[model samples]
Target chain A: MTNISRRDLLKSSAVTAAGATAGLTGIASASNHGKHNHSKSKRVVIVGGGIGGATAAQYLKKMDSDIDVTLIEANKNYHTCFMSNEVIGGVRPMDSIEFNYDKLAEKGIKVVFGSVINIDPDKQRVITKDNKVFSYDRAIVSPGIDFKYDEIEGYSKEVSETSIPHAWKAGPQTAMLLKQLQEMKDGGTFVIVTPPNPFRCPPGPYERASLVAAYFKKHKPNSKVVILDPKEKFSKFGLFMDGWKRHYGYGTDKSIITWIGKEAGGTVSKVDVATKTVTAEAGEFKADVLNIIPPQKAGPIAFETDLVGDLDWCSVDHKTFESTIHKNIHVIGDASIASPMPKSGYSANSQAKVCAAAIASSLNGVPMPDPSWVNTCYSIIAPKDGVSVAMVYAYKDGKIIKVKGSGGLTGPYNAEDRKREELYAHSWFNNITADIFG
Target chain B: MKQTKLILIGSALLASSTFINLAHATVIDRATILANTCAGCHGPNGISNGPLTPSIAGLPKNYISESMYDFATGKRPSTVMQRIAKGYTDADIKALSDYFSKLPKKATEPKKTNNHHGHNH
Candidate 1:
C-alpha cells in the first residue's frame, strides 16, 4: 500500500488542477441548454441564494439537463457569514467574502432577484414581493437563519443597526463591528454575548473571540476579551482551551481572554446601550465594545410560507430532506431540523447535494438512493494556529446519525500541526467556493 | 392431491417472476448518485482539472478500494479524504471503486492559469 501524508496530498497541484477542470467542464458537457429533445420539462424553484440554495441549483441542472431551475433571491449579492470574523480581525476584506449569482445564471438557472412573499404548496407555486408568481414541479427552500432579538431586553433590530452589531449575516453590521473593534483603546474590555444552543456555527462565538484577541495581541497588548456564553459546552472545547492557554495566557489572573459558561451565570439577560453594559444572571459588566449575538430561529421566509411547524424549524425526512408537513417541497441547510449536523457552510453544501440527487431521482421516476453526508469545521485560533473537527453521517433508523469510527478531532497542540491545519483551512475556502459558484 | 401440488408450484413460480420484475423496474442507481457527490470536489467522472484535488478516474479497483479503506481506517491520512471516507460504508467504497475502475484512463488538461480572483461568475 502506498502511504500519503496530509501535507503531500495538499501539495499535489496536478490533482487540484484536474479537479478544477473537471468541475467546470463536467457542468458544461452535462447540460444541454436550448435543446428541446426531452418529452417533458420539469421546473424547480429555489428560494435563498446562500451555499445550500446555490449548490442545489447547480447540481439539479447537472443531474438532469432539461430541468428548468429558477432561483429567487432577495439580494443581488450575497455576503457570506462564514469568514466574516476574519474581516473583524483584519485578515480578509469584506469584498473577498461576497458572492453573486452570475455563475448560477451561466449554468442556465433563471436567477430572479426578488423576495418570496408566499408559497402555495397545493398549487406548487411561489409568489414574490413584486407580485410575480412562479410555478414549479419541485421547490427547495434554504433561507439561512433569522435572529430573535426580543430574547434580549433592550436589544432590537434598530439597536443592532445603530449601536450593537451582531455581524452574523455578514453585511453592514460586519463593517460596523470591525470599526468598533479597531477603535477601542488599549486595556479596553470587549464583551461578546453568545446566544443559546442550536444557533448557526456552534464554535463561531469562540472563534470570533479568538480572532478579536489576536487583534488586540498585535495592536493593543493590554486589551482583553470576555465571552459570556449560555451553553455549558461547545464544539472543540478542549482543543480551543488548549490553544488559548498556550497563546493567550488563559486561566491566569492577567489572561487576555475569559470565558464564563452557564453554570457561572454567563447568560446575558439584558443590554444597556447607553452605558454599554450587559446584565447577566451573575452580575452586570461594562465594556468598551459590546457584541450581542441574540437567539435564533429559521429564517422569516420559512415561517411566512408556513413550512415551519410547532417546532421553530422545518421538519424534513432525513433520507431526502423533503418536508414531512408539505408535499413537493424540500428544506435544506440551517432552516431545516438537521441536527447532528451543525449549521455550518460545509454541512449546508453537503445537504444540498443530497437534496438535489433525491429531487432528480424523483423526477426521473427512480428510487432514491441511501444518502451519506460529510461535514468539517475549521477554526483559526490565531494566524497560522488552527484546529478542526470532522464527522461523517448516514441516514439510519429514520434519522441522520454519525457514522461510527468515521470522524475525529485534531490531535494535541503542536505548532507544525496547527500551521498545517491553517493551510488546509485556506485551501478549503478556495476549493469549496469554486465548487459552489463555478 | 396431485392437481393441488401442480397448482401450488405454478403459483410459486408466478410470484417469483413478479418479484424479479419489480426489482428490475425500481433498481436505484446507487453508483450514479454516489459519483455525483464526488464530482462536486474531484470533477466530473473523477477527472479533476483543479490544482489541489486529485483525479481518481480509471484507477485499478483494488487500488482505489484499498486506498479508500485506508483513509477510512486512518492508515492513510488526508485533510479531507478521511472525513469523506468515513461517511461511506464498505459496500459503498467497493461500489465506487468498481464503478470508476471500468472507465478508460485519460488525463484532463488544465483549463486556466492561476487566477485566484473572484470566481468566473
Candidate 2:
C-alpha cells in the first residue's frame, strides 16, 4: 500500500476548496505513481477557454483528482463578451474584462494555447492547428458563437473589419465602435442593427442602446441612438421601454433613443458602406456611426468537428449536455441547443457546472445525478437603473424545461430596487468570474 | 448461552447501523451534485463569504426546507432564489436541506474586495 503523507492530506482538503489553490505538483505525482488504483488514467479534453470551457476544466479537476484535464484555447487572453457593451460606452477598460489561464493552470488544468483544427470522435482525439493530437476519454466543446455575416447583403467580413464594427466579440471591434461613437458629431445619428431570435444575450441590443443613450446623454447631448431590430418584442421589453421613458424620453419625438421593431420595417437586408447607410425593409437609414450586429450560429469549431447537424446549433441531451449526435462528447454554452436558457455568460457557467458533475460521475462509473440549471440575466438600463429576469430549470420528460411560478422580473421598479439590483449585478459578475477563473 | 447469543446479535445490528451512518457521511453523490449548484454564489457548502449573499450551511433542516418551500410557493419575495426554488420538488428540497444542515459550520470570512467590471449576462 502507498503511504499517504500529511502533505497529501492537505492537498486533498484543498481540493474541497474548489481547487483554487491546489498545486499542479500533486496532480503530477499522483499520475506518475498511479496511486488511485484505476485500470487507466482518465483524460478529459476541453476546447475553448471561454466561461463554459474554463469552468468545466476547473470543476472536473476539483471533482476528481485522478482525471487529467487539458484545455485548448486559441487565445492567451479571453475577453468576456457579456459586459463588452460597457466598454463601448467607455465605462470599463478592455484590460478589466480580459483574463488569463494561469489560474486554471495552478488548479492542475493544462492550458494549451492552440486552435483546434479537427476532432475525431471515433478515435477520441482532438487535433490542433499546430499538428498536435490530444486523446481523451471524454471531450467538451464550447467554442461560443460566430457571426453569420452573409445574412445581410452588402455587409461582409471585410466591411465589418474596415468601415463598420459589430463589437460583438468584445475586442478590437468593440474598441473601434467606441472610437466611432466618441468621434461622431453632435446630433449625429447612431444606428444599431439587432439580430434575430436565438442570439446571444436576448436583451443585449437593448442594453447596448441604453448604454449608448447614457453616453449620449452625458457626452454628446443631442446625439441619438436608433435601434433597427428584426424581432418585434425583446427580452425585458416592457421594463426597458419603461426605463427608457423614465430616463431617456422613449416615446417623444426628441427622445434620444428610437427603436423600430420588425412591425415598423426594422428588418435590415443590406448596408451601404460608402454612404454609411443600412437598407431596412421599411426604408434606408443613414448613420454617422453604424453598429450592425449580424445573425449568429455556433462557432466555426463546431462546424469543423461536425458537432452540429442540419440545425445551426449542436443538439445535446438536456440532462447531461452530451451531444446527441456523438457519443462521449459534450457541448455547452451558446453553441448547444439549450432552449429556454438564453446564451448568456451566467447560463454557460451554470450549464458548465451541471456538465462537469455529469462528466465526473460518468468517469467514476457512477450513476449520473438529476440535473438542474439556472440562468439570471441582469441588464443595466442607465447606471443605477437596472432590471433583471431569472429562471430555474429542471430535466423533465426527457427535456430541460423551466419550472413554472419560479423566476420573475425585478418587481415594482423603484430607484432603491434598481440600485440594489445593479449592485447585485456587479457582485454576480465578480462572484461568477472568480468561480470560473479561479 | 441464549442471553449471550442475543447480545451478539444486538451488537452486530448496532455495528451495521454505525457503518451505514459513516458511509452516508463520506459518500457524496447525488446530494452533493444538487447542492454544488448553490456554491456558485453561496460559497462552498453554503458558507458564503460574500456580504450580499447569506451562508446557508448548518442551518436547521426544517428552516432551510421551509424557506425553500416559501420561495417555491411565491410566499417569499426573491430576486433569484424564487426561481431556483421552483426547480426543486418538495422531496428534492428535503434531501438538499438534510444534506446541507449536516455540514459543519465555518466562520464567515470577508470576500476579497475587488473592483469587478462588466455584466456577466
Please provide, for model 2 over B10-106, each residue's C-alpha lDDT reduced to its tens digit, 9 standing for 90 to 100. Answer: 3344334311111100122666667766766666556654545556779899988988877666676555566678777777788889888987677
lDDT of each: 0.77, 0.78
Instruction: Report the Cα lDDT for residue A16, model 1.
Output: 50
DockQ of each model against the real complex? 0.10, 0.15
Best by DockQ: 2
What is the TM-score of each predicted model, taking all chains together? Answer: 0.82, 0.84
Q: What C-alpha lDDT does candidate 2 achieve relative to the native structure?
A: 0.78
Q: Which is the leading candidate under TM-score? A: 2
Task: Give a tens-digit lDDT track for model 1, residues A16-56.
Answer: 53355232212111111122221123678999988899989
| Weakest lDDT window of 10 consecutive positions for candidate 1 chain A | A24-33
The weakest ten consecutive residues by lDDT in model 1 chain B span B1-10
Cα misplacement distance, residue A386 of candidate 1 (Å): 1.8
Error of 1 at A71 (Å): 0.3
lDDT of 2 by residue, A1-438 (tens): 113433355345435432344222122212111123322336789999998999889778777755679999999988888778888888978787888899989878889999899999998889998888887778999999999998999898899899899888877888899899999999899999999988988898899999999999998999999999998999999999999998899999879999999999999999989998999989999999999999999999889888899988999988889999999899999999999788988789889888988887766555577787778888999998767888877788889888877776877677866876776666566567677775
